[model samples]
Target: MIVETTRPATTRRAARLRGALLWAAVAPGCAWAAVRLGGLDRGPLVQLLAFTPYAAAGSLLPLLLALALRRRGPAVVAALASAALVAVVAPRALPSGQPPAAGPTVRLLTANLLAGAGDAGALVDLVRRHRVDVLAVQEFTPAAEVELQRLGLDGLLPHRQLSPSIGTVGSGLYARFPISAGGVRHNRGGWGFDQAHGTVAVPGAPAIRVESAHPSAPYAVDQVGHWRTDLAAQPPATPGGPLGILAGDFNATLDHGPLRALLDTGYVDAADQVGAGLVGTWGPYDGDWIPPVTIDHVLVDRRIAVRSVAVHRVPGSDHRAVLAELRLPAG
Candidate 1:
């Protein structure tokens, strides 16, 4: 005869507690993804909280969850709650407009014309059509610069600051208004491209400080951490001003930690400000299965009001252009 034995109450309680802890650990990632989906501002703290599990994936959390709670029902429920939170919060964060009463509205266009992109002529046409007030270009080659000038952009926009470094394959800022002082940052990396900043005179309005940055692409976990550190060290060149703007190929998504840090500094993203849906700027050159990412961005300080923001498709570059119209508050 065999005796039937039951597990002790302590064992059952321990298993349940373990399951609850595992579920809690996985819940934050779902919340993070949901925040991004709901268009809520993902700050550095949020990113840190969300990415901890993925960063420490080699540990026991996933393994235990797989062995004990294979169903993942609790995880699914947590993710759904996170998504619902995003839906509730996104609408309220958007900016509200009064009327079109404007003093000087600056229409700026920022583009990352890929180094070898063959669509320079198409880009020129776009500039003329849009009547762009200030144009900030990244991945700007010397050859492209000459071609752009030949296409009559120089005539349209006389004031300019170009750092066509062969070593860096850098950026160029061309403006319709006079540029007071402009220079590239001293920091140099493996890519050799330095950050570019300038002050553009807006006539009756305040001078706007603009920075064109192309930080290293954070494809790996370490790279993402490095980007965060670099961004924190190098702040925008907003010299005692109420208005500042930074626009370029940030090389990171809105969900990324470094980008969130930039947003937390009281600067409003022009795309989010205008309520434009997620605008994907980067695509594979050969058009592969890789999904498009919105690595490009235009962020403005709170004092400067955003009228509208749009992404313009340029023919040759793998990245699209971001156009933003900013309204300065009445004096």
Candidate 2:
């Protein structure tokens, strides 16, 4: 005789509920993981989700699950947790140091001149109008450099360092102040993980250590993982009294883990401190058709005070220029 066996109806119902809730809890996390793994670009939908991956994981994912399961508490709790995590983690990702002074300040301007762009004249005009104290630029092609020099930037920013490799346009740092010493650091092959460091002199203040970096964009899995490892391999800021400021086209957004490591190390974001709006710096040529993203950044140590931050539009480059005014603490 065949024996009939059946599980309890209540137990089966409970198991089904638990499984549904588990999927709901993990769906958004999966999406967030995908984005972190470099699966999305700087489009509107992706940008919005990118800005708040935790929300996607917590709120959106749970809501989607709730629609099918008729449960709201789990989703609400998950969203709150995600939001809290973002709030807690974001500020920590920025560089932190002493606050800025209420007195005189130094102005810095940075841009990534797309190698093929031909509008050096417009860039020169922007530079002249701003009279920036230090100029940190990436994607500096030879022709672009010549045009910039012709526009009088060479005269204005006499002290300069140009990288040897033209591929990825390398990187460049120009300053009105004397550069005691500077050179490229962490030369990763074909990755464009280049950096330029120099010293800036401010009246009545000690020399400040500045570094301009352009890390690889991390288009593939290995690239993204390698970039993160590269960032991790970065040595801690040298022990010195001078404040540290690192600015450049990072090629990654604020949400990425590599950037998060910088912030966690006590770097304060100049734009965030000065309440600068969402200054998307890429895809200017596409107009409303293409989405915008703020991959370029100016991050300072906590000891510095941020006065203002703005993005200046230029004709030739895809990225808008980032200008920031910061005050160093008196010695």
Candidate 3:
């Protein structure tokens, strides 16, 4: 009798311990899902949201553990959390059906040169090999501008609107076609990063306004507000007015609220349209000891059709260049 009674009690204790362990394993994922689904990423969570891809991948481990343990309650919760995250993240790998848009093809490339330290020759080579019609450059410096012009970038892309500074605040836009209304503007409400803008006349298609975007990064708790402001300051795509494109290092991912809000204003991510959205464009390239994430983007108006998108490594820069082949809406 005593032995049997002790056996039952031990089994009960083991069951309780397993229940507690399962909850512990599942809770973090559930919390993360809540934050992401609710779009509650503010302050430090701004930085945290950049790694949502990793978190989405991690949510699976808890799910497997719950299934193996045969804990129905925890398993249900884990499944819900996993489902929510996967629903948001997994579709990025699948291409959306292409809309019917027939127009002249324009090849565009955008790069952040790490305060003008990136290899000018490699950048020029990418422009040449890709037959890039337009180039958006960020973190441009005076010395780097001289280096690029010396490397024959001017010959390849003669029309230019450049704002080269001594630090990472500068931006520029270069085009093979003539660019009118070309100018540079600073984000006055946020960090004063230069954004170069112009209307490119691409032969048979309608003129499209292109801007090199460089929003302030939310690297710290205090800077989150500035980051939000900078992203919000980006001009919205005019579906009714004219064709528009915003390209360069946005410093925020699609998971970010500010960026999503911007996209909701009628822009489509070129890579996302073609199932190349999961490719990482930042981190690891600069020896940061962190996993790569997609932050650099080419956001075109919803009317434009994205043909293909690619990312390339540039030596001496922390960011990889994004090349997008776009079909503009015919005039």
Candidate 4:
């Protein structure tokens, strides 16, 4: 009789275990890949794309397992999934392609004041340290405004465009250069925050259109639609027109479709242009596991070259402050 060659029982069991582990790991990775690629705006599932970076990095674990088990098929699938995720998100980490322009460097600072709870002294110190030419504040309460004036921000900045509110909607723009009143408007059913825009006239340079944006947070299921509309309320950069500078608590990340759409308006986030987009600007002050993410941004006209960008803690506010140094074309 002819004997048939058969694998040992332990080898078969081991192969089954390995295969099980591979699928267990690959399943979650594949789900993330789907959201990242398709961008199906199905609320909760869509939110998972926000952490695609972490998912991309963590997906490699399965690939490693596949290698150890000599599972070629699963290894290939895992490798492709992980590569696609990284490829999609990798652009955010790359520096902008635009060459540095020949212009005066403008130091800008933006922060969320936590409805009068943020530390005015600390903010002032940061401004002084950076020699900021422009400052945009969000969630500026009456108390925060009073504190700023009390703390001599008016003297240092000289010009102001304040839109104070009781809660998260307030904002302000303080600048060393001359700034004309750019009315505080909340045109989106009072759901959008009071965004204060002003024309900043820089000496020997183009007058930059500056705005302070504090759109409603999209944390809850009900608020999600309002949040999208609020972000859309902000006008896109006027093509072939004056360079507009927008900075504040957008409450939306690059992963969010609405925010990405906003960028399609011919503006670029300073942090993204300088390879710091992945570096988050929101987190617990005491360094909790809250997993910091970027929601605050300085969207500038594409003409301006982003030199460098950094984030600092905003006391009393869950959101951090963004500091960006931009090179504007000289007049």
lDDT of 2 by residue, 160-195 (tens): 876623546457788887886787676463364567
* lDDT assessment of candidate 2: 0.66
Candidate 1 per-residue lDDT, tens place, 1-331, comes to 1232344566778878877787767665465555554545333443343332232232234434545666467655544544444453343246555334355888888888777363778777767888888888888878888888888989888988787654335788888989877987633333544567788888777777787777755455545555555555455434345567888877765555556677777676788777763556777546596556667888777677788888888887888889898886553
Report lDDT (CA) for all predictions.
0.67, 0.66, 0.92, 0.83
Encode model 4's per-residue lDDT on 127-202: one tens digit a residue. Answer: 8889999999988888899988898888889898888889777889999999975778674723567888899988
Q: Which residue runs of candidate 1 sit more than 4 Å off their true CA positions?
A: 1-76, 79-81, 84-102, 116-118, 186-190, 237-242
Sort every candidate by TM-score, greatest first: 3, 4, 2, 1
Report the number of backbone clashes for model 4: 0
lDDT of candidate 3 at residue 188, scale 0 to 100: 61
What TM-score would every model get versus the actual structure? 0.73, 0.75, 0.97, 0.92
Please give the lDDT score at residue 116 for candidate 1: 39
Candidate 3 off by > 4 Å: 1-3, 286-288
lDDT tens digits by residue: candidate 3, 45-121:
88888888889999899889989988889999999998988888888888887767888999999999989989999
| Candidate 2 or 1, higher TM-score | 2
In terms of lDDT, the poorest run of 10 residues in model 2 is 41-50
Off by over 4 Å in 2: 1-26, 29-71, 74-78, 85-103, 116-118, 233-235, 238-240, 284-290
Candidates sorted by lDDT, best first: 3, 4, 1, 2
Better of 2 and 3 by lDDT: 3
